[model samples]
Target: MRTQVAIIGAGPAGLFLAHLLARAGVDAVVLERRTRDYVEGRVRAGVLEQGTVALMERLGLDARLRAEGLVHTGTNLAYDGEIFRIDMAALTGGSAVTVYGQQEVMRDLFDAAESRGVRIVFEAEDLRLDGLTGDRPSVAFTRNGVAQSLACDFVAACDGFHGVGRASIPADVLKVYERVYPFGWLGILAEVPPVNHELIYANHAHGFALASMRSPTRSRYYVQVGLDERIEDWSDERFWDEVETRLGPQASAGLVRGPSFEKSIAPLRSFVAEPMRYGRLFLAGDAAHIVPPTGAKGMNLAVSDVAMLAEALTLHYAERDASGLDGYSARALARVWKAERFSWWFTGLTHRFPDMDAFARRMQVAELAYIRGSKAAQTAIAENYVGLPMGFGGEPSNR
Candidate 1:
């Protein structure tokens, strides 16, 4: 098969790009190693930054999102169970975040792709990219034990961190920066009303805990755990007890406990691959960077990567301009690094370090107290929470 762009992976990054290209009259095909059911079934982050919400509307896929998404104008932070609110919408000129699950976003993208005639190849195994350094590039993969080849003008590597896209870059040409945290988050999804109308991030002597939701009826919560912690040791009763203790009585007063349907532990990390473009291939989403979920920047970061990337590709096709493509790496990395810093900072503020001395604990308390009393501090937090303008400063603002 021949096309203008060969997109690897059918995740949010890849699927979003395919839809954008289709609208711009660019021909592309998406290849996924797993079935659509498997891809959509994976439980992931549930918060959407305004840019992501805007992208959905621009693609004409926001009908369900607008109708069902729970909007939060503010978020809460707790220092030893004394919670303080950060009015994100009021502080950021009416900017707010939508609580919509990443899985739902993928489902909507998939359904629209099928109806809009965006092509996606599922169960495509062993993807390989060739001639990325040359003028033209081609992708090869096997499906159902049969080999296939696709010729394309460019290759988009949205396959993820373990995929062949970033790995295809020469080691000497790629420089990586990463920091793995000493703790992981033990997260659970339960069928119950959330304790509060807005999400809460708590800092306790015990650990860090987050109370969030997928919808009003489905609640998602997480508490920090040591690296050696095991899922088997955490029962529903024990988990709820930890939450109640950490959240303090004020916020936990209305807390409801129920049987958890999904539970897992995920390690946190901050990672980035310098120069997102290597020849004809471009990296977006997890392939290029990862942020700790502390700031809820993982999925939102991926969306912004593609939003900037899609605009670049659109410019190349529509106006015969290569500047956007040439500068894609620098432009996207600028935004990616800011998110990394925020996630790292937020994690440090809320999580108890294995090596945190009393001095460090006091400093955290002092900082939270300062933020509570200072409008300037709250504004900074609110703007970052709502998401920085797609263009950090000098880049184009993506709609």
Candidate 2:
């Protein structure tokens, strides 16, 4: 098979890229190592930045998102038993975030792409890229135990952190910056109304807790846990107790307890790979960078990455231009590092460190107090939460 682009992974980044390329009349093929069901069911982040929402609308793939997504103008930050609300819309010039699951976004992208007859091959195995430095690149893979080769003008490595995309690049050519947190989040999805209407990030003496929701009736919550803690160690009742204790009295009063259907612990980490391009191969989303879930920037970052990439590729094929493609790495990384800083800062603010001394804890309290008392601090928080403009300066022109 020959195409203009060979995309690996069926996640949001890969699928969105394929859809964008299709609309631009660029022939591209997507290869997924998992089935469609598996791709659509993977539970991930649920917050969409304003720019992401706009991009989805521009693509005409947000009918369901517009109807079902919870539009939040603000988010709550709790510390010292007091809740501080940052008016995201007010502080960010009427910008707001949409509470929509990453999986749901993938589903929407998949439907939009499939209806347009974009080529997507599932259950692909042993995917490999070759000749990325040359004028042409090819992806070798297997489907149903049969060998296959896809020749393309370029390759997109959206296969994620553990996938072959970043690994394919020689280590010497890449500079990696990473920091793994000392703890993890024990998250649960339950069938109950959320503790509050908007997402809440709570800081308590014990740990950090978050109250968020997927929909009106389905809630997603998380409590900080030790790195050694296992899902099997906490029962439903115990988890609820931990949540209530950490969220303080006001926010926990409305908490509804129910049997959780999904429980898992995710370790926190901040990571970024410099120059998100390698010859003819470009990496977007998790394949290029990762941020801790504190700022809810992971999926949104992926959206922006592809938005820029798609625009660049569209220009290349449509107008015979190469400037956008040439600058993709610098443009994308400039925003990536800002997100990393925000996620790291927010994580430190809300999470209790294992080695936190009295002075450190006091600093945490003082910082939150300053944010709560100062409009400037709140505005900064709100700006990052609602998301910076696509390029961190002006609105992205992709849409």
Candidate 3:
């Protein structure tokens, strides 16, 4: 197979990149190691930054999202049973986030791309990029026990953190910055109704708990705990009780138990890779950077990376210009680092450290109090929450 772009991985980043490139009259092929059903059903981030939603709308991929997504004007920050709502729209000039699962977004994009005749190969394994500096970079992979090669002008490594894309880069040329938190989130998806109108980020003595809803009929919640905790150790009753204790005393407005749909743990961390590109192969999304889920920036950042990449590739192919391509790494890393900082700030303020001394705990509380009391602090939080501007701060003209 031959194309202008060979996109590895069919996750949101890869799929969206292919879609955007196709609309720009670029031919691209996407390869995924997982089945279509698995990719579309995997649970991940749910919040969409305002810029992401706007980009989707411009790309004509927002019909279902607009109909099915739940929009929130603000989110509640709860501590010691007191709640403070940071009005995102008020602070960010009417820009607000929409609560829609990452899996759902993937489903929408995959379906739309397929309907538009985009090529996507699933269950393909052993993806390897070879001869990236040559005229035609080749992607070697196996599909249904048969090895095949895909020739392309360039390769976009949208495969995630554990994928081969990140490993393909030589270690000497890469500078990895990472910090893993001592705690991880024990996330659960329940069939019951949500406990609150909007997301409730609670900070309590026991730990941190997030009360978020996927839809009107489904609730998604998380509790901070040791990374090694087993799901079997916490019964349904115990989980609900812990949630109530952290959120507040049990009441009608409190969370009610329901059939658990999914339970898993995700370790919290902040990571970034300098210069998201090397030679003819470029890394985007989780392959380039990762952010803790506290600020709900992981999926959004991935989308942002691909959005920029698609534009860059379009410019390169349309105008025979390498300027956008040359500056792609720097432009993408700027937003990536900003998101990393924001996620780190939010995680540090909310999650308690095991070895935190009395003075440190007091300082954390004081910081939270200051954020609630100071309009400037709240505006800063709200601005990051809504999203930063897109398109590298210039007109959409090709660079």
Off by over 4 Å in 3: 250-252, 392-399
Model 3 residue 77 lDDT? 84
Task: Summarize candidate 2's per-residue lDDT along 215-327 as a digit string, tens digits.
Answer: 99999999999999989999999999999998888878899999999999999889999779999999999999999999899998998898889989999999999988999
The better-scoring model by TM-score among 2 and 3 is: 2
RMSD of 1: 1.7
lDDT of 1 by residue, 237-334 (tens): 99999999988888788899999999999999999998899999999999999999997898888888888888888889999999989988998888
lDDT of each: 0.91, 0.91, 0.86
lDDT of 3 by residue, 175-283 (tens): 9999999999988999998988789888888889999988998999999989788888977777887888788653225667886879888888889987788888999
Q: Which window of 10 residues has the lowest lDDT sum in candidate 2?
A: 390-399
Using all chains and alpha carbons, the TM-scores for the candidates as numbered come to: 0.98, 0.98, 0.97
Q: Model 2 misses residue 320 by how many Å?
A: 1.6
Candidate 1 lDDT for residue 284:
95
